[model samples]
Target: MKAIVKSARGKGAELQRVPVPDCGPQEVLIQVKATSICGTDVHIYEWDEWSQSRVNPPYIFGHEFSGIVVEKGNLVQNVEIGDHVSAETHIVCGHCPQCMTGNAHICQNTEIIGVDRDGCFAEYVVLPSENLWKNDPSLPWDEASVQEPMGNAVHTVLAGDVVGKTVAIIGCGPIGLMAAAVAKAAGASRVFAFDLNDYRLELARKMGATDIINSLNADPLHIVKQETGGAGVDVVCEMSGHPAAMNQGFKMVTNGGRISILSLPVRPVEIDVTNDIVFKGITVQGITGRRMFQTWQQTAGLLQSGQVDVKQMITHHFPLEEFDKGFQLMLEGNCGKVILHP
Candidate 1:
């Protein structure tokens, strides 16, 4: 098996021959057909402070993937061989308080597949049976590889009811674009998307955003207020993770509106809670990962029904041997979610 392996910090990943892994008693062996490069993978490659603290060296890097089950362990009775599948990257302990209460997405004891352990950037990968999800045969492997991130979009938008409400997304990245489509499909009256990059904002427009805001020039708050008749938007999805964008998102929400945050900010920044959140009576919710099987079911249904245009989010594809090129594309911000074939 050939895998792109990160042997040390601040080093380029190399394609090396490695032994294939066998399945555990409760796991299944999947032959990876397609995988996508995520922002976290770029962070790991750059050996940033966050990745230095979170990721140990010599780990296979990738989490968003779709493949076929080649073999199943004896204890894995739900899934079978030859089934098309994707997986929940977060492996949770079912005994935790959050898991017992049916909120496994935020389980206290969680190990992410690529970050904490080996991931799906290789010819074959092993996953716990509980994390594997069966995919509809009508979908292609390239499209299925996006389910993990698409699930993030679904969880963010579905955190609150968006039907007949005006919604705004503060970022036009891959996940943000997905959120735009999901919000429109879920019956949002108007979808506004904001970003610094004009290219991404264009993509957001194609994804069903009724209005696009280039924050570099126009004032997003004023534009959103004017678009909504000064009432502001009913829902604000903050996906930029930038301090300024986060602050603006809080201010863009209407009174009693809901704000769902899906971005992971790197540093602690001060916010004007008095005017932005407290005085406005806004409902703020922090979103992390997916909602376990619930998010998967909703995302799968949307994809199967062709309600969400996920294929538009995939702008580049590369072979496994060209992993470095794919990472460079992401670092340069030249494309959308880049897919890799192993």
Candidate 2:
């Protein structure tokens, strides 16, 4: 099997021949058809502080994938062989308190497939049956490969009721673009997007954002306030992990409005509680990964119904052998989601 391996810390990923993993009783073997590069992959390539602390050496990289189930373990009854599928990357313990309360997405004991274990950038990959999602045959493999990130957008945008409300997304990355589409499809009266990159902001406009702010040139808070007649927005989806953007997102929310944060800030960030939340009387919600099956179902329905079009988000594609090039493009921020075929 040909796969990309991160064999050591601070080393570039190398394409190498590796043995396909065997499936356990509760696992399923998937023949990898398509996978995509994420910002986390760039972090690993650069051997950043996050990767240094979380990822061990000699691991396969990549988690967002879509493929056909080649074999299913005896214990895997829900999914069958030859089924088209995508999966939740976060493998959770079914016995945790969170899991027992039907909040398995935030299980105290969680292991991400790409970071904590072998991932999907290979000819074959193994996944727990519980994490697999059956894809509609109508969804193309390239689009299905993006369900992992699309779920993030679904969770962020749907955190609060968006219908007939003014919504502002604080980033224009792939997930943020998806949020723009979700906001519009969810019936937002007006959707505003903010980003430093003009290219990404333009993409957000096409994704259904009624207004865009290039944060580098203009103040997002002023623009958003002006657009909403100085009342701010009804909802703020914070997708940029930058501290400035996170703080601005809180300020951009109208009184009694909701702010859903999906970005993972790498370090501690200070917030002005008095001015941003207390005085404004805002509702602040921090979102992590998807809400497991619920998010998947909503995302799948959105895709099937043409409410969220991720095809434009996939600006580049490459063969597995050109993994470096894909990672380089992501690092340069010149492309959206870049798909890789195995």
**RMSD list, candidates in order:** 1.1, 1.1
TM-score of each: 0.98, 0.97
Q: What lDDT does the true structure give each of the candidates? A: 0.91, 0.91
lDDT of 2 by residue, 50-71 (tens): 8898999899989899999999
Give every collision pair in model 2.
none
User: Model 1 residue 253 lDDT?
Assistant: 92
- lDDT of model 1 at position 155: 99
Worst 10 residues of 2 by lDDT: 37-46
Q: Candidate 1 residues 126-213, lDDT tens each?
A: 9999999999877899999999999999999999999999999998888999999999999999999999988888889989999998
